[model samples]
Target: MTVNDKLQADWEPKSDAVQRDQRAAYDEMRERCPVAYSDFLEWSVFRHEDIVRVLMDPDTFSNAASRHLSVPDGMDPPEHTEYRRMIVQYFQPERVDAFEPQCREIAAKRLQSLLGRDELEFIGDFAHWFAVRIQSASLGWPLEMCEPLRLWTQKNHQATFAQDRPAMAEIAKEFEGYVHELLQIRRAAGAQASDDITGSLLRQYVQGRPLRDEEIVSIVRNWTVGEVGTISAALGILVHYLAQHPDLQQQLRTQPSLLPAAIDEILRIYGPLVSNRRITTRPVEIGGRKIAAGERISLIWISANRDGRVFEDPEAYRLDRDPTANLLYGAGIHVCPGAPLARMEMRVAMEEILGHTTRIDPIPERPPTGAVYPGSGFATLPLRVR
Candidate 1:
């Protein structure tokens, strides 16, 4: 192959067809070009085993892929370990269980609002609403912050997809502004500050010193992004999946206890978060393709989890599938610290949805629109609920 041919993009991740249907596009890339490159994502890793190799060897493939600070998500080794240890406290079983009542309450309130509305756009009306509400409650933020946070997430996604450096920097600054205001409020309160997660972060110390304001903001920013963006997309995907599959929907409704496993399996079939970034720490060959040191990598989660080699009949929903192999919340040391909270939120949301509604069907005239690139799941999901 010529030098130009070897270096040229094997596939366009941001192309129109791929954006319309990412899972299918990634499936094609996995077979046709397992280690594809594009200007947008640099190197896109498709297969399950190859992605797993990258995940297992964080030293070789670093999580510090972005130029901006991502708190624990962008960190590795001793630094990642220290911050992750502190961040994980918020998602512990007890903490998650403690937040359950409130999560259900938020879901119930949302469902109540949708009552009697048979046909509605589920994305804005419910998914984003519930995600932000639950996130606000968990972080001790006022309900007033939900709309702004949701809007911020949308802008963040747009900037990320376009790779607009200036906009992304401004967006990051805007998020930091939101976080700073919260910090100031708690700092103003002194000893009387509410004993919630945000307040807890203020008190948290790392590396033998109290957390700085920027670090705290970065931490909260990561949490909010995961909670608001990923969870909202995931809810849309889950509800849309159920609306399309009558038998699975019926089964889930009949056995309410199965919602958690059903939720995982369904999400596995159609993942929410699209891809995560990694950078090659040294010259490495992935899937027989030589990648130079300092090159960027994109681990396509939606594609990796659905790999036919690792998963027999990958598209088929199976509660019996190996849980260990699923990269939904990711793998290795950088595995999402908020996974427990996310799973709980999804389960609670589904339980509330299924328990309240007798059926869920998609609106034929208004087919669900798929979210593109950095986002996953339906951008607009019109569902008929009864």
Candidate 2:
């Protein structure tokens, strides 16, 4: 019944299989051993309750699990809180509202451009393109920079997940150069009269001192590396599901007020984030298992979303499900601060697409390839726009 007992039971593949199929694998583990450990990746906390507990108590399950990938966002409370507050205001409702119309316009233009095409790959043609452009514009980056940034971000992620050290070093050098150039430009221009997110990050300070150059680089890298691909993946999932369920789509079209709830449901059903690992600072008991200090603990968000104990009809997607129970945006203090921005983008996108097209359906005989971690989702989601 304990974690050790479960570890003795059997070993499961955490990474080999494609993520979509891994849900069932995680569920099986949750039932047998919620706090499962592997020699390769430390312990995997699979249950909703267990993952939530760890998220809430950062002292016990420290966030400084790993340094390279875990940014300030992944650090523990006092430290995490400071970094978060530095820019939380930029994602406030008013700021999000200001960006909403722009987001809607972007979605409309993208949809218009691809309208009437025989087939359209939503991931590249729509999702990646829209997400990168919006992110670039939001931060006051040059419009021309979006494409190159997108390419770099993709390569950066690929190299990291692949664990290719040489490639990572090369890409990091390139990224450092890019951020350095941007920093110089901002320094020369002084503070502008605009409220752009990047400008705020540049002008903002912590503890009465400006954020260091490397800190700025880390922040921008995390934003692009963390957000863009996930948003694209989420978009692909949304389009895939919507295409499969014409009735639900029709209902949402008729009851457009349901768009927000529908988006929440879609994210809950197939959220972009997969799992994140944290290290134990001391021995802790979880799901009747004893996890020793210094062991890696993976909080599988995607698995928790499909947890049958917490969700009714866990496999089925229901738009009206209560949002309180969802783990899609994560939990505790480390929960995604960019959630409001992501929601705004998603809502505006769906609203625009539905307004212009009679129906959005999937193209049969062509399924997109799954992304490996640090990224996942459709390589090419060719959908019928009409």
RMSD (CA, Å), each prediction: 1.7, 3.0
TM-score of each: 0.97, 0.91
Off by over 4 Å in 2: 1-20, 69-71, 191-195
**lDDT score of residue 48 within candidate 2:** 89
Which parts of model 1 have CA positions greater than 4 angstroms off?
A: 1-6
Residue range with the least summed lDDT across 10 consecutive positions in model 1: 1-10
> Clashes in model 1: which pairs?
none
Expressed as tens digits, the lDDT of each residue in 135-214 for candidate 2 is 88787788889878889878987786677889998998788788788777777777653456665677778777988777
Candidate 2 residue-wise lDDT at 71: 48
Global CA lDDT computed for model 1: 0.89
| Candidate 2 C-alpha error for residue 287, in Å | 2.5
lDDT of model 1 at position 341 = 89
Query: What is the per-residue lDDT of model 1 for residues 253-310, given as tens digits with 9 covering 90 to 100?
Result: 8898888888888888898988898998888998989988888899999889889999
